[model samples]
Target: MTEMVKGYNFAFIDEYAKREIRRKVLKAVSIPGYQVPFGSRELPIARGWGTGGLQITLSLIGQKDILKIIDQGSDDSVNAVNIKRFIEATTGVFITSDTLKATIIQTRHRIPEEELGDDQILVLQVPYPEPLRIVEPEEKETRRMHAEMDYAKIWVFLYENIVKWKEITIGARYPVMVAGRYIMDPSPIPRYDVPRLNNARTLYLFGAGREKRIYAVPPFTEVKPLEFEDHRFRIENFKGKACELCASTDTFLDEIILDDKRMYTCSDTSFCKKRGNNPRVLKYIDRNQQ
Candidate 1:
């Protein structure tokens, strides 16, 4: 039993290690947009498998806290489900699919539909935290560029691309200027999640395990998605369609391709999977007749 116990619970990270992570988190919260480097631990989970998010969750989870997790906006997505199970197994904390019930949420790729309040905290798993990563491959160079707010190269690159392609030609993981100081990666969240970050009520934290960086956006921070005055900001969507399963018009819809029959249905799979029977999802449907 002693030998078996050696490989489990908190993995290889000692209590001191966790305390170090807690210290970095505190610094991240105190100085918004400033990157705090921490000694990241090797979890049982592999790198880029939401390891950063899991570390933040482990460090901050108090005895009484409800946790919610989502990947690409779906609770049951394999990565999200696995991470949720792992955290629950380690902490014995209750996990909820409902966004509102959660005090702490760790997410990848998408933000939830519900508006977050100041009481909640959102943790983002960032594959790459450096916004200047494309322009300067070396971490050392990017850090210098950020310190000087030298983004002339990024703007020139974008301008050249538009000149050649007749459009910006970039989608998802778009760069943004945070607090008009640091140019930050808003993780890989869809463009829809970009606007939601602007002056949001919730505290937002980003962690990159591979890079050993942690950062934050305090409540009411100015997060501007990279854009032009004439171009404005927008999110992609299927026009004039509602979810077939939940019939939600306002929710983000996933296009489901039905086999090779050339037929498709608009469905908000997350909503359908969560609350199909709830009144909010089924209000317009005649369930009794069915």
Candidate 2:
């Protein structure tokens, strides 16, 4: 933690609200990819500004928990810095930019490039929680579709994308089938990060404050992106380009233009720093050494 504040509870929320949120989180974990409704409480921050994830983190955090907050894979960004300050002030818990040291990581928009272990919990900030909403507008109709496991319309949506663009045009928020059951919107994570969700060690918790929804993906769960036989799902390819700073070819690279020249860099800042400092990481696998 940066520094502890005198006023406020250990985790900033009352005991009653914490218990309720915990119960809802358990239900979401029991049924993977199933959206569980909860009573979203008003926080100090605005509703659409990461309140859902902040709420979940507040509910789950303990004294021993080392938290990490990131926005779009950066630690020093405006959103990340503000959220980190809020969390450390309220909880007084240890905060780290090092991905491996964090027991609970609250993130928006992007998952860390380093693989998370079973001991870690990743709390993702979701703007929208419903995957079926793309095809069905009403809440009742979407609930019915989930209950019956009817996903023909969403399938048609994908099929139509392939028909027109010759590929899946979804840039982010890729719809994935969780545990071969419910189709979930993986919270705007890119296609590159989609593959990391399948049978991973980390437990993923998604919170949508505005939507009053919470969902989870437990350890070793099967998460598959929607794809066909011929037109298979693919991640963004850099065409042999590597990160300009880290020289990492295997990890995801962000395209940048410096002085009218194309440059590629690692979106995960910690990953870039780790590789840039270590000479033995030539294998290019973005894993935490510690």
Candidate 3:
């Protein structure tokens, strides 16, 4: 562990930066799907990693906030652990792995298996904030398309995918219509977590530091994944597979290979541990699904 320099502001980011970020966050929340540009300051971490999410977490976190950070749904992952420790050391905020206990969760690639309450806020680390980037690389053109609400290219791309694969081959970073207005990418979260974003009770804030963009999904707002009437959006099916540890069929499972033997386990380590110890946790997952 590196020794901290004496008399630094909380979370390592200066007060001015935090204030500016908060302002941008407010603007993002007001617009829902509109991406708000910000002056992204360089952090100790390099760009394209988690600098975006880290900045957001550091800005919003307070001494009283109970923070939880996870990568691919595991609290023990290297990125998660480092971010959690950094935040704790800087802000002196309490940290926990329990989803229900956390007031704020900063995640990469996954959302927790447990349902988040209205009081909780989810800060997602986004590598690419633009849904139209693949179709239109030019920022000015994409902005013009967004201004005119033109998504023909996006629709065409989806249609072509269906024509070739017979199904939407996109497994992650699924494009969605936010509040039936702007098209937004919900980061690279698995398709399983897409439904959780629909009219979610908790607020969702997306940050892309490398891109210097911030977007949000306010609580109870509409978020529909792009799909056609005949070709509806589908989640990743486990094909009757369940977690070997907790026997959870609904939660996302990670496959591990050991000595050529394949094993399945829950990706959300905390949820799996709780479920393994207490059978009643199944009810929570069921209720959340409803």
Please write out the lDDT profile of model 2 over residues 12-131, one tens digit for every residue: 888899999999999999999999999999887788788889899999999999999998888988989998888888887888998888999999888898878889999999998999
Q: What's the TM-score of each model vs. the native?
A: 0.87, 0.94, 0.95
Candidate 2 TM-score to native: 0.94
Question: Residue 160 in model 3: shift from native, Å?
Answer: 0.5
Clashes of each: 0, 3, 0
Off by over 4 Å in 2: 1-3, 282-290
Query: Candidates' lDDT values, in order?
Result: 0.77, 0.89, 0.90
Give a tens-digit lDDT track for model 1, residues 48-105: 9888877888888866899989888778789988887777766667788777789999
Query: Which residue pairs of candidate 3 clash?
Result: none
Identify the superior model by lDDT, candidate 1 or candidate 3.
3
RMSD of each: 5.5, 2.3, 2.3
Q: Which of 1 and 2 is ahead in lDDT?
A: 2
Write the candidate numbers in order of decreasing lDDT: 3, 2, 1
Where does candidate 1 stray beyond 4 Å?
A: 1-12, 260-290
Instruction: Answer with 1 or 2, whichever has the higher TM-score.
Output: 2
Q: Write the per-residue lDDT of candidate 3 for residues 97-192, one digit (tens) a residue.
A: 999999999999998989888899999999999999989999999989988999999999999999998998788999999999999999999988
